[model samples]
Target: MHVLELAKRRKTVRKFLPDKPPKEDILKAIKAAKEAPSGMNAQPWKFVVVDDNWLKAKIREACEREEEKFYSHTKGELIAWLNAKGFKPEKPFLSEAPYLILVFGHTKAPYWLHSTWIAVGYLLLALEELGLGTVTYTPPNPKPIKELLRVPNEWKLQTILPVGYPADPKPKYERKKLEDVVSFNEF
Candidate 1:
């Protein structure tokens, strides 16, 4: 499929089937991710693929704790939207998905965060092409998760992607009109 179509078809999969995806397919997506451009060619991203049930459970517990704190303090439109979408402090996907791809960025690299996110975008699309599902889940505080994953201090946690075959059908979401977000030269 075309890249744009792949992008459009890729949705945030909250519920996933229990079946595990092939390791080679996940590696293939990572292969695509590594090709993304980075600042000064300093490919400063690291992807940790987790498939252990015990580790996934620990990760889920840590994420839920942070999410609880976040939900307690946050208010307004974002919370309302999340509530409308049936989201909660509990992060079941962490344990339910067959695999978790933990993305990290080396803090010392210039534009590390930006570069890492670009790579994540590439990963998401590649996974979509390979018929896998995932959602970008960023913990409110990554310190605990970092320690749990045994990630080095120099590597900052970017996001966690819970991957599997989607359990539910993809829902259609509307996007803003291109003209509404576009301009000719000046704002």
Candidate 2:
């Protein structure tokens, strides 16, 4: 697909088919992710792919523990804000998706503190291009998940992705006009 078409098709998948992608496609997506440009070639992205049911359950529970606390106490605009952006208070996909990807960003590597985002962008696009679906989440509380996954303390959990094929294909929201977002050379 063309870049623009791929970009247009790439959307946050909330519901996914139960079946997992073929191993070759999964590996290809990871390989595509590695092609992202990093600052000074640091390439500081580490992904932990989880498929075990027990671990998936644990991760979902930990995520919900934090999510419940946030929803119960957080009122007013914040709740609406998150809801509008498609944040599900209870993440069924974490347990139901065929694969879970934990993306970690190493802050101590070189001068690039944001190289991990490049890898994430690449991963999402690659998955979309390969007829897969993914939901990306960066929860405020990640230590519990890290401990559960046995991720080293030095690494930061940038996001948790629930990946699989979409349950349904539909046109997603359109972007705002560029005229509203751009300011030419200066803001």
Candidate 3:
């Protein structure tokens, strides 16, 4: 598919079908992600794929608690922004999706955070190419996730991607025009 069309069709879908995608497809997407360029070729990223129901439940529980606190405590512009997106504290997709990809970055590395995010972008495209849908999620706190997932202390949990075949319809969103987002060499 053309890059433009692929990007245009791609959407962040929260609802999903219960069917699990093939493991090979998941690995292929991860392989593409790992190919992303990193600072000094450090490739300071790790992906944890979670498919277990029990573990997903645990994650959902912890995340919901944090979200409750976040919604209650956070106010003003942030709340308005969330409301505009139709976002709520509830997150059932975490447990409902067939796969949960946990992206981790090496904390000690200078550009690990940026590199990992770059990889995540690649992963999103790859998944879309494979006819899968995902929503990138960032939990309120990492401590619970680290403890529950047994993540190494040196690695920081960055993003969570709930993967599955989409159950929801495509949402219409208005994006800023190219002119509004891009600036010439001299800003």
Best by lDDT: 1
**lDDT by residue for model 1 over 36-57, one digit each (tens)?**
9999999999999999999999
lDDT of each: 0.94, 0.85, 0.92
For model 2 the TM-score comes to: 0.91
Q: Residue 32 of model 1: what lDDT?
A: 98
lDDT of 3: 0.92
**Each candidate's clash count:** 0, 0, 0
The window of 10 residues in a row where model 1 has the poorest summed lDDT is: 166-175
Give the best candidate by TM-score: 1
Question: What is the TM-score (0 to 1) of candidate 1?
Answer: 0.96
Where does model 1 exceed 4 Å of error?
A: none
Cα displacement (angstroms), candidate 2, residue 138, comes to 1.7
Please give the range of 10 consecutive residues that has the lowest summed lDDT in model 2: 106-115
Q: Which lDDT value does model 3 have at 85?
A: 79
